[model samples]
Target: MNDRDVMPAFDMLMEELDAIVTHLNQQGAQLMQAKEYAQAREVIVKAEAVLAFQAKVKALQEEWVRLSVSSSKKTPRKKQPGQRVMTTMLKQGLRTPNEAFMLPILQALVQLGGSGRVIEVLDRVERMMKEQLNKYDYESLPSNPKELRWRNNAQWARLNLVQAGYLASDSPRGIWEISEAGRALVLEAKE
Candidate 1:
């Protein structure tokens, strides 16, 4: 019987279970809204099962931690910023593709405020996305190309951010400001 052989697989399963619980919770919310109590209840029961499995996984984590640390040869371990960014973003309620894009932009917007820096960052991001993305329109922009791109992406991001309570916008000034949620997201990204 090899205990170490099963440790990584168990850890992977724990992560999957955690993600499943989050998904079930989200789906359960929609079901509850639709008044489908039966479906929501089923989801809750399944989530409980996952939680039970995780209790076992947590006990196994002790063994895995010892194995990983002892085998590393190096004393102090360092994690990269990108890995930290992913971990923090995942810890928050960002579990969607649109959220993957929108959250970073929201965070950036929150940091770079009404100053010219905000426009610069937006321009840089829009340029990168436009270059990377195949189908993007350039015509609908205002006189400035920077304004054009911001007009497009910021407009879409504005609706989403506002709905999520992360941003405030004034149509007359074409300025966007971060709300409390946006600040929280930015801090999460920083961490």
Candidate 2:
């Protein structure tokens, strides 16, 4: 179903989940009061099932967000007569290669001793890209005026690296770090 349909379903699911949680809580409380150990265990098992369903719903929401972000598109603006176009390194589009940004991000993390804030890493990646890749500029997606498309690619690369066990996810908010595997990957790539 489309988002329009899914949204209502999501809301309904949330309501159902809330009701289930309330029921579970009440039942557990009652069982505790009666000191019914066996029934309490059953309630605990039911609570686990509720948690599983909640997790599924959360996963669905996350997937929706990812798909929506990646599928976003923007139309290019017509340049005025005197308007100079930005650097011609690569044209803007969904086709921009993310691989070019990955190594630079990894290298930036290594230079920072394998950990840093996201924005700091992003700036480092940009500088490295300009110097090493000769990528003077990248076009921004239509949905964003101040953001460059390659930056998004870099973020995706970071996510992929995290999934590949090359980055750690336990850092502070807005912070990322290279795992031991990432350092090894960098060394291997160099060789």
Candidate 3:
């Protein structure tokens, strides 16, 4: 069955389990009042087991949510030879390489005084590289149709920059910042 069908079923199961636990607790209390200590202990132990199972199920549900959100953000690239050939054929003379965004991104951050919001940085970078950007760059990405291809390339470039230590890895979310090394590289380039 699909997620929509299974999710409600899981919810219903959890609710039923909660009711069962409540019943067990009430039964244990009644047994305690009647001085049946061993029976009360057994009921409490069963309730604890059910609670533990519920905890595990909740953890699994959380993990599933995390995985689904991450997977939906980006499409995975296929390494098949046929897919590679098709992509190469389709992309001929169209988009700029990811590296093309590096200098502009660093420059944009520098201009913004070391850090800026993602959209602001990208806007500045776009103005800087206007002539270099091609028609294909303006098109939407296949993976995320709402995002432009060049913006996605720029984001990939930012990821590479972070990996190479040219950008700050611990910067606040939605803000892009250049590192000291990145600034020095820009200075060295100017020399």
Candidate 4:
């Protein structure tokens, strides 16, 4: 490829990498405040990517410096650090049906106790949630894969308990013991 074509693509990739890095460095608390789980998940992935890109950039710079010195060419220009080019944190995610399905189940899982569903678990769930999770006024959790509303306080307890890996429901039958993963979620929540 011609130098002209090569340079622009590299420049564009660098610009994108820079933009990703800026986004990734946001405070952990700010990331948690994300309104949706999917969005938060994207941010975490992007943040990790940013860190990766920075590592790549650093490695490239080191190699470039070595090559330039060997070839007796002037060092390539370097962009100043910490300035954004693309400049936006766009809204994340499509409200697709599949996401809609998994979301409620996940949110419901979060509500029920996730690890354990004792009184303390319920209390913690209520507190972590910005909204109330009671029977009468329980708002819809995010939709899951099947478009089930994941509605009902019964869901609140059931999903969370199930997700915590404790208490697998046989549906109209009964729940079994909590799994180790369930125990972990409960323990983490408590901590």
RMSD vs true structure, all candidates? 15.4, 15.4, 21.4, 17.5
Tell me model 4's lDDT, rounded to 2 decimals: 0.43
Please say which candidate is ahead in lDDT: 2 or 3. Answer: 3
Q: What is the lDDT of residue 51 in candidate 2?
A: 85
> Tens-digit lDDT track for model 4 on 47-159?
78777776887677556555543333456556567643332221222111121222233334455544343433334434544243323224233322232222333344345
Ranking by TM-score: 3, 2, 1, 4
Instruction: Give candidate 1's error at residue 54 in angstroms.
Output: 33
The lDDT of model 3 is 0.78
| Candidate 2 segments exceeding 4 Å error | 1-95, 131-137
lDDT of each: 0.55, 0.71, 0.78, 0.43
TM-score result, candidate 2:
0.48
**Tens-digit lDDT track for model 1 on 68-164?**
6434234544776544211111221222223334555665565476222445546645654554433234433333434443345455555666655
Highest TM-score, which number? 3
lDDT per residue, candidate 2, 58-166, as tens digits?
A: 7997787677643224466798886755432232222435556767788899999999999999999878777444332365744456877777768877775775566
**Cα lDDT, model 4, residue 96:** 19
Q: Which should have the higher lDDT, number 1 or number 3?
A: 3
List model 3 lDDT by residue over 40-142, tens digit each: 9999999999999999888876776665632233355567754422121223335776677988999999999999999999999999999999989998865
Better of 1 and 2 by TM-score: 2
Please give the ranking of all candidate structures by lDDT, highest first, separated by commas. 3, 2, 1, 4
Worst 10 residues of 2 by lDDT: 87-96
